[model samples]
Every structure is written in C-alpha cells, then in structure tokens.
Target chain A: MRGYAEDKDAYLKRLRRVEGQIRGLQRMIDEDEYCIDVLTQVGAVTKALQAVSLGLLEDHLEHCVAEALAEGGEVADEKLREANQAIARLVRS
Target chain B: MRGYAEDKDAYLKRLRRVEGQIRGLQRMIDEDEYCIDVLTQVGAVTKALQAVSLGLLEDHLEHCVAEALAEGGEVADEKLREANQAIARLVRS
Candidate 1:
C-alpha cells in the first residue's frame, strides 16, 4: 500500500543497502568490534530506515491526507488525528 | 535546509494544520478537555509531524546519502556513520 509498490526498484535498492548495513552490524557484533564503531553503524541504519518511513509518510500526507481534506468534512479532522498520532510515535521513539 | 524550502506551500499547509492542532491541544489543556480527548488529539499531531520528518529523511537518503555511497570511499563510510547517528536519534526519541 501507500504507493510504495510503484517505486519498488528504488525502495528495494535502498532497503538492500540497509540490509547490508545490518549484516555488517551483525558481523561487528560477532567479532566483538569496538562499541563505538558498532553504535555508529547502528545510527546510520536508523537514519536510513527513518528515511524510508518519512518517504511513505510524506506520500500519504500529500495524496491521502490532501484528498481527505479536499472532501471537507470529518475527514480532515480524522486525518489530522491520524497525522498527530504518527508524529507522536516518531517523536516518542 | 533539506529541500523543505523548495516546497514551501505544501510544507506550510501541513505545518499550519500541525500548528493548529498544537494550539487546539493547548486549548484542550486549558479547558480541561477529557484526558483521552486531549491525548488522542496529541497523538494525531505527533503522527502528522513525524510524517514531515520522514519525508526529509527519505530525501536525504535518496539524494545525499546515496550520493555519498556512490563516491565509494571514506565518504560512504562517513555517510553511513551519519545515517546511523540520525537513526539513533529517531529511535531514541
């Protein structure tokens, strides 16, 4: 959903890189790599994943949220609530 | 930064609603709206803002991060470190 399938190639590429980074991290863990080095890799992975989440969220807002707003009713309010909860989760996390 | 200035209208619109939601939440607090009602609204606003963050993060990875990776050197490693730090912040938050 959320139009992600439409951009499968690009998404998959990014995800693959992320997956590689994850494996690298696993190796670091197994090898007892320096804590700072491992943590640094972790931070990169986090940002990368966050980037994907953000893309999906933006697309949802621009398309779905905008459409709901255009309809003009409880939809706007409802979408607003949805958006708020999402932000909260991001911030909370 | 982060290309947000390019889409001023759209970003502003989303931000405005988010701002309004924030104000509404403040009012709810002042008026002592039902705790659940206020919290629910808060959640909505949180999700909305997170959407914005996610969008920016995605762009960074696609453009900046990807470019960094392509350079194929210390840049890739450095960008990876940066990405990890960013993700850590997101997750920590």
Candidate 2:
C-alpha cells in the first residue's frame, strides 16, 4: 500500500476542494475580474495546492520514509534521497 | 507586473483543467472505483499540477529572475535565492 493509503479519502477530498477553487478562479477571470483580484484567486489556488503537497509530503515522511529507514540498507538510502528531492521540489514550487 | 503576467491566461487555463481532473478523481472514488484506478487518477492529478508548477517556474526564471538579474544588486541576489529555493522545492516534490 502507498504511504498515504490510510488517508487516501482525505487527500482526495482536499483535492476536490482545491479543484473547485480552481474552477472559481477561472470563472473570476472570465468575468473580467480586476487584475489583482484574479491574481489573488491565483494565489489562493496556489496555496491550496501547496497545502495538499505538504500533507502528502508529511505522510510520505511519516510512513514511506519511516518504513524504508526501518528496513535499512540501499532502499532506505534511496528513500531518503527521494524524500529530500521531493522536499526540494516543493520548496522551489 | 508579475513575471507570468503575459501567460496568466494560459496558467489559469491549465489550472482549470487540473481542477477538473481532481473532480473526476473524486467522482471515481465516490463511485467505488478500484484502488489502483483511483490511484492512477491521483497520479494524473499530481502530474498535471507538476506541469503547471514547472511552467510557472519557467516563466519566473525567464521573466522575474531575468529582470532582477538585469537590475543587479540586492534585488537580484534576492531573486536568485528565491528562484533557487523554488527550484529546490520543485525537485523535492
């Protein structure tokens, strides 16, 4: 099972909400919303997605990485590197 | 103006599609979709979001970072650091 398998439902639900927010943003743009206003919505969408990413990262660290570390050896090292890379990507985003 | 101001519409449009994909994943889950199938949708959503992130990053580098670099000085340094951090985060993700 995936690291986030336990919280799969929650993740999906959160994504759904973010998705709705995105749609709302598009509508705002279509309505010829003020530039800053549209940008604000964009910011909101970005934040929401970021939140989801953080949650997934936390879950991965708690479960996948933890499990890999417990197992030890090459797999553990790989997992650690993977986690670090994932974190770096998130930070950049 | 924001670095991505020129492609704001494109960014918004891509986000809208991602949002729809998220909704579709949710619906699939609600309908008792197979685990792997649902997970597949989740993967699709993740990839879509990543694509958007990459595009935004590209725009930032091409515009914001470039402009800042041209100005030179403290602002340029700040922009460079910000871009590096952003890239790191993306890699981690």
Candidate 3:
C-alpha cells in the first residue's frame, strides 16, 4: 500500500493537464507541426513524467522497501534486488 | 529545488542496499551465476526503483507543476510543456 495519500484532486488535475498536452502533441503530429517544436514539447513532457515517477519511487523506497527490509532475511534481499533493478531501468531510460 | 526534504538517512540507507545488490549482481556475473537467478534478481530491482520514481513524480506534479500553473500565462504553458515531455519519456522507458 502507499505510505501516504497525496491530494487526489491535485493529482488528478495535474494528470488532466498532462493528458491535454498529449492530445496537443497528437494534434501537432496530425497537422505536421514543426519538428523542433514537437521535440521541444516532447522534452517538457519527459521532464514532467520523470518528476512524477521520481516522487513515487522515493516514497516506495522509504515505505515499502524499508518495511520489507526491516522484516529482514529473504524479504530484505528481495527488496534490495527489486531496488537495484529499478535503478537500472531508470538509468537505461 | 525540492519542495520537501525527505528523510536523508532513510533515503541513503535504501540506496546503500541497492548499491550492494548491484555489486552482488556483478559478482554473480563474474562467477557465472545461474542465468535465471540473475534475471530474477534484476526484475526485483526494477520494481523497487519504479516505486521510488513514481513517488517523486507525483510530488513534482503536485507541487512544482501545479504552482507554476497557478502562477499563470507563459509559465503555465511552459510547465505544461515540461510535464508532457516528462510523461512521454516515462512511457517510452
């Protein structure tokens, strides 16, 4: 479970904005918008998504991973392994 | 800048364990550990890290992006652009 519940309305509002951005991008593509402008918008979206992912990742490590590790032994090892793979993915991306 | 200061020690501790897991994986590779086992561990790490990223991303959207949007005009558009690019990157990864 999530250790904390972030503001639902705020979360949804941000997501909604992102959704609009995506649709705009789609429209841009349909209309053949300038390549650079499209790319620039793409970069913005990437950063925003990263920001969101980073928050979740931190919370999970602090709560889920920590709790599992506190339990010790195989669980700890498992959580450690899980974390490492996650980092690898982030780096690869 | 970060809007919040997460627990430093706790964050470091989790990172340290992940670091150890990586080193262990390296050793496993050197020793020709079972391919299946290595892949399994790799998967675990991926999930752990994803959890962390998600937490951070949520916070960024809620705080940074939202604040910028509330400020209005070009700032809102810029934030929206940034966020869209971020989500794109996340999906690609």
Scored by CA lDDT, what does every candidate get? 0.70, 0.68, 0.66
Ranked by DockQ, top first: 2, 1, 3
Candidate 2 residue-wise lDDT, A1-93, digit = tens: 566677778877787778777788667655655433444455555566566667667777888789889999999999898778667655554
Give the alpha carbon lDDT tens digit for every residue of B1-93 in model 2: 665677778877787788777778677655655443454455556666666667667777887789889999999999888778677655654
lDDT per residue as tens, model 3, A1-93: 673355446556777888999999999999999999999999888777766666555555545655664465787567656754664466457
lDDT string for model 1 (A21-50, tens) is: 999999999999999999999999998988
CA shift of A90, model 2, Å:
16
C-alpha-based local distance difference test score of model 3: 0.66
Which candidate, 2 or 3, would have the higher DockQ against the true structure? 2
Candidate 2 chain A, poorest ten consecutive residues by summed lDDT: A34-43
RMSD (Cα, Å) of candidate 3?
A: 14.6
Model 2 per-residue lDDT at B16: 70
When 2 and 3 are scored with TM-score, the better candidate is 2
The predicted structure with the larger lDDT, 1 or 2, is 1
Q: Which of the CAPRI classes, incorrect, acceptable, medium or high, describes model 2?
A: incorrect
Q: What is the TM-score of chain B alone in each candidate?
A: 0.82, 0.94, 0.82
